[model samples]
Target: MLYRYGSLIHRRARLVLVIAVLLIAGAAVAGAGVFGRLQGGGFDDPGSESSKAQRLIDERFGGRANLVLLAHATGGSVDAPDAAAAGRDLAAALQREPGVRDVVSYWSAGVPDLRSADGADAIVLAHVDGDATQRRERAGQLIERYAADGPALHVRAGGETAVNLDVNGQVARSLAIAEAIAVPLTLLLLILVFGSVVSALLPLAIGGIAIAGTFAELTALGAVTDVSVFAINLTTALGLGLGIDYALLMVTRFREELGEDRPVAEALATTVATAGRTILFAAGTVATALTALLVFPLYFLRSFAYAGIGVVVIAALGALVVAPALLAVLGRRVNAWPVGRRRASRSAGTAFWARLAGAVMRRPALAALPVVLGLLVVASPLRHVAFGTPDEGVLRPGSAGRQVADRLATGFPSNQNASVDIVLTGPVDRDRLAAYAQQLSTLDDAALVTSSAGTFGHGTRAGEGNPALSRPTGERLTVASRLTAKSDAAQRLVRSIRSAPAPAEAYVGGVDAALIDTTHAIGARLPLGIAIVVLATFVLLFLFTGSVIQPLRALVLNVLGLSAIMGALVWIFQDGHLASWLRFTPRPMDTAMTVLMFVIVFGLSMDYEVFIIGRIAELHGQGMPTDEAVRTGLGRTGRIVSAAAALLAVSFFAFGTGTVSFLQMFGIGCGLAIVVDATLIRGVLVPAILRGLGRLNWYSPAPLRRLHATVALREA
Candidate 1:
């Protein structure tokens, strides 16, 4: 199949190139509007009870406050005439804002929960009415207009909309900075690796097509469904990285074929036939791994699936169709413009990787034992892994939302800003509702519980609460915890609230509730997600290699490499190692980001794994011994793998410059994973393991062998 495709490219190279150009041009034009179409947050499970609770609140009550304005008396008590006047003025202005409603503040209701313990700072709660995109836009506008130090009240913004806005904004800026650092460095490194200016340009062109095409896909998907804007970062990073990966393989083989003195047409056809098959298989593996994200309900993970599959498929197409055409056209000039030397990939059997493989094969057990133990130790931090959703704390210390969140944590007696909201859906019994509120009030961390009946303090009815809690069909209850919402205590309190007997059909939601629901949602599907990735990857590798043992070997090493990366992330990001240098708060890893990083690293590690194993498989099929095939394959392909991994690592590493902690963790983790995979896993473990397995590496049952011979994906 690939041979025919390659033959067509050889015959109609110009036509293919022209078509690719037209498509890329069309993609760029359509993709320009993607940012506007994309949204800020899809971290919540839309079908979860917390989500239903939020929707019920919006439909019945005005809606739980999705916006918070933390106000401080500049020089005196908030109840002072001047400070009280300024607080009321601020609330009135917010009440009149176009997207704002349900303005509740200390001065407006004289609510003790709205005022800080010290009586010097207070909070204003308002519901921002919109979808994620609209809410963020509205919040940005409102914060810009109202969140500043005034004559009497100094206000800062922190809430769902504000935190999402801050995260999305930081991601955009981080991507820009990452690109600024990565692109030039990648180009220069490509030139050095390719040893020619002309060869280096092909990968960039392919990357461009992948990115533009995926952006166009995102634009279309965004218009109809929920798509996170964060996917843009993945589109850019993975698109370029995969482009370089595929192009490096194809161009290296093309040059190797041409160096055999074959004509351009024959060489191009062979390169396409071999490398094209490899590219397709690699894309399938990556797309399969990324497809595991589809099982997740959160559009944050699903959006990455959309972008990842798009980029991988498009990159593969670019490599198979566009790269071959370009290689055919350029032919001898593909190796043109040598920088300092005309050095290209050599078939010399004495390369450093070849010697390393030889040494390892001589003592596979000795080489394998220590590296295994080291990765296991590094991955020991896995036991301490914990997860939470992204919050304002993801931003740097001085970020506006973080400032508000910090004050909410320390300045207030209890953070009313992080209330656990419950909504009754059926006809309400005021008696049962009051009883429920009293029950909620007794929760270990509950500070206050407000409902239509009244406010409960320590299981006792205090006084009349916000009148807004009452509605015709149902009632709304807000429970404020003394502990911060991200805390274990807060999670426990939320769980207790949900378990407590309710007056009617109740849905519990808020920061703490949403966190519990999100954790549960992701946790429930996590085993299935892992199963899909693992089972599919195992099958794909089996089909490619026609050997069960090979797939098992791949899985073990891939896990080892990824385990170390995860441990490093937990240690550095979660445990606060190097927190000062990175300028990010130490907290639990973002559940969604951690999953995204795992699949990305897993897919990409398999990408290199397939390359190395494919080369060895080919050499062994040519009648070489296992040890000779391993040495020769590593010698031939090591430089390309190193170069590609370095460029890819640099691409991800640049994101470490961001102010957002999760993204920074993601950047550092991915870069570290690549370096470790390339050097340690690919460099040391693979060779040692292969040596240990020997002929067992290619073993398959007779029936399966026959099946593979009939339908297997062919080696390059």
Candidate 2:
């Protein structure tokens, strides 16, 4: 396979180069027109409990989803006529702004009920179209324009739209900070591994091209749909990860041949045939894992699924196709600045992996027990993991969004600006509805209740069952109530409300309720996604390795790594341990994080599976004894695995510097898992199992044995 493909590619180098270039160009052209307004179907407008509360108001009052709440007080008497006059002026100016569909201050018609009895503090709510980004910019302009007015009103914006905008800003800046660190560090690591500056740069170049192409595509897609900023960061990270990984595999193979004294063209051909083929399988596995996310009901998960697929495919193309062409052209120049080259006479087959495998074989049970126990210990924290939506605290505590959120929580219901809506039927008068609303308000969990008559206090909205509810029109009445807390508390409140005996023929739905439903929906579906990835991985690996047991072994080890990592994240973030030291606040993991973790861990685990299995398979194909093959294979691949793991770990570690809680958790979890998987599971336990199983490692039923001979992988 190697000689034939290498000869063909070398003979048609020009044609291969031309074809690769054209493919890349075509992808780039197709991706170029994607802009913010023309986004792909994957992007969605980020919705939260706060946004849902605002939506309740929109549905009830015919207003917009965006709101702007202003705090007004003069130096001395806030109740003075002048102060009130100034507040009204500020409100009027806001109402005049473009896209300001409507605005209501204390003076607005039918709004005096919102004012404090003493009139010392007041707020203005505005309705607007578009996303939080546009609305937030408008809010800032409003604040800046109103801050210097007479008597100096302290105007601060607090609402779902505003907070969403603020969070978006923080996320964007944090990604910039992370990229600034990870990209350069990745390049440096690649350079160090490859020896020459040029060789090291190959990964960066390919990754950069792939990312550029993806972003351009995303931009065009954004024009027609919403694209979360987080997707951008995710795409970049994945592209870099896979690009460097593929380049490393190919370069390592190329160096091995050079050491064997093969001609440059022959070495390039062999590297492409062997390493290139392995990359394809590795990429196939990763893409398969990522594609599983599409099965998730949420649009957010599907978007990332596509993003992951795109990045992995592009990286594989760079490695399997472009890399060989470049090597063919460069020839001996590829080693012009060889840095980590081992002496030609000393084979990687002589590395410490053989000794480690021997030790593991001698104590298979003991060796496997400790790694499993260690992972279990690390995984203990996962039991304490609590799920919640991302909050303002996920951003820097000092950020505008954080400040505003704090103010709302402290001065109003803990779940102020967040509510659940219930629509009831039958002939109910204002008094009955008011009594019902009041009853809801008095519930231990309710915060501030209100209705058509007036607000109970903060976030509680009293229901106004006017003649509308009894009329033949069958008017829809929405009951809104804010909880005293976010996350679990809010979810509980929604559950209690749903379970309560309300009027007959009533339907309940709000942001909190929706989130609760979403959470449950995703949680229920997780097992399905896991089963798909695990089952498919087994079938694929079973076929690839011709071993019935190896695939199961891989699945068990990967699960151990994942569980251990999740537990550590739970202890570190959910429990708030070491959060201060890391300059972050611990918050519950959101649905998105859980889904993402499953996908990323599965894909990453496959990289190790293929690398280790490829080496073992190669030795077996050469007719080596099972024990000798396992030992030699471990020895040959250990350093490369270690190096690759280290590079990925460092890159992930860089993300810990981010302010976002999920990103920080991701950084630590992935970094720690990679270390454990590379050093312990792969290095120690895999060898033990292979040794204990002996010939079973290569065993396949007669029916499948033929398939292995034909479709089974040949070593790259």
Candidate 3:
């Protein structure tokens, strides 16, 4: 099948090139539309309880959303007239902004109202009827407008508006820095691995086109579906990584064929037949793994899964069709730099691999025991792994959000708290509501509270007809409590409130609230993701190798690799044991990140597995014995596998250099896993096991054997 494709593409190189160009152009045009829709309306649907609450608010409250800003004097009393006046001026200035709907401040509260109910701080609330991006910009302008007069009143803007603006800037900067490192480092690694500037550059160009196209498609899709900002980075990374990997495999095969005395068209055909088919299978596996994320209850995971799958599809097509077409045009030049001594035939039984396998088989217990023990020892730390959401402090210290969050943590609570909604079944007495509200003020973790009844009361209130009655029926009261902490602390507080056995049914909802629900959802569905990936791998390998045991062996080895990687990660980040050397400030791992790592690492590890198995299968077809085939195949593909793994590791590690600790942990963990997988698992362990098994590597049930022979298992 691939031979015909390569032949046709070679014969009509210009036509094939035109098609490639058109596909990319179409994708570009479509991506612009996707971007436009995304800019107009962002998708915030994660389907978590917190998101459900936010949705409820959006549905129940139809007016423009108001962002409250508090500008307090750092060195002066917030009660001073000047401080009060500055707050009023800033509020008025915000009111004049293009998107501003209204402003609420002490000055707007009529005559002589200059202090908050607490009498310690003044407040300014700005209302904006706009998208999140516009709201953030308006907040930025407010900061600039009040800058000169701020210090005189010790004015520091701290509110949802300020925090959102700061967080947006931080996310943008982190992405920019991650990409800045990822791109150049990717190119350098390609150049080294391909040993040719042109080949290295080729994949980047193809990947760039794919990304542009994917973005265009995503933008178009955004018109119908919500595309988060995070999707952009996901698409870029997926497109680039897969693009390079696919093209390199084909190019390597094409070069080898040419060296073996095949003509340009024939070499292209062979390359397509072999490497192209393999690329398809590899991408199919990756896409399948990513698609499992759609089962997640959160839109965040679903969005990532879809975008990643799109990139992988585009990358696979580029390598299978576009790359071969391009190769046909520059066939000989693709391998202009000749590698010496091309060996056409491999022996039936190789000495080194045979001996190595014998050694492993002879000491199977010794060899397997030590490796398994080592992995377990590394994995031990995960028993104590604590999960938490990332804080702004994980960003660079110079970041505005980090500085603000740090200040807030010091002055307020630990930064993990949420704005809660406490609803009552029936409410009639304003004084009783006020009494319950006063109790909220006395809670140890409550740094601040905002309520409809003016002030919160102390201690729990219990009465038959009280607004604090614990019921989920009509006529409810709501209170928004800003807690001191962010992730776990907020989660604990929410649990505490719900578990208090109080009369009123309380519902806490915020980012922390959303994360808690999302984390629970992730834990519930994570096993499904593993099962999906494993099932897909089994099917792919069973068809490719015609052996059940071989597939099972690969699965076992992959599990070991994952355990080792995760164990090491828990040891470093969870335990805070390696904070000094790695320059990492340990924070709890986001639940989503941990699950993401499992999918990504497993899919990537499959790349090496497939590559090795393909080479072995090829040699076996040429009549090499099982032992000789394993050795010879390893020798042939080892360099490429090692180089590819190294390049992938370097690309991932580049992300670690960014200010986001989550990205850093991801990079380091995956990077370390790849190094271990390529060397320890694929290189040492698999060979040792295969040596013991001998012809068992080819063993399969008669029915399966017949099916495998029918399929032919030709990847390219």
* Local distance difference test scores for all models: 0.88, 0.68, 0.66
- Ordered by lDDT, highest first, the candidates read 1, 2, 3
Estimated TM-score per prediction? 0.98, 0.88, 0.85
User: Superposing all C-alpha atoms, what RMSD in Å does each candidate have to the true structure?
Assistant: 1.5, 4.1, 5.1
Report the lDDT of model 3 for residue 38: 43
Lowest summed lDDT window (length 10), candidate 2? 36-45
Candidate 2 per-residue lDDT, tens place, 8-47, comes to: 7766777788887787777677665443332212222235
Candidate 3 residue spans exceeding 4 A from truth? 29-45, 59-75, 95-129, 140-151, 154-168, 337-370, 390-393, 413-417, 423-454, 460-483, 487-489, 499-507, 577-585, 710-716
Local lDDT at 94 for model 3: 71
Cα shift from native, residue 511, model 2 (Å):
4.1
Candidate 1 residues 492-526, lDDT tens each?
88888888888788889887788888989999999
Task: Give stretches of model 1 more than 4 Å off.
Answer: 344-350
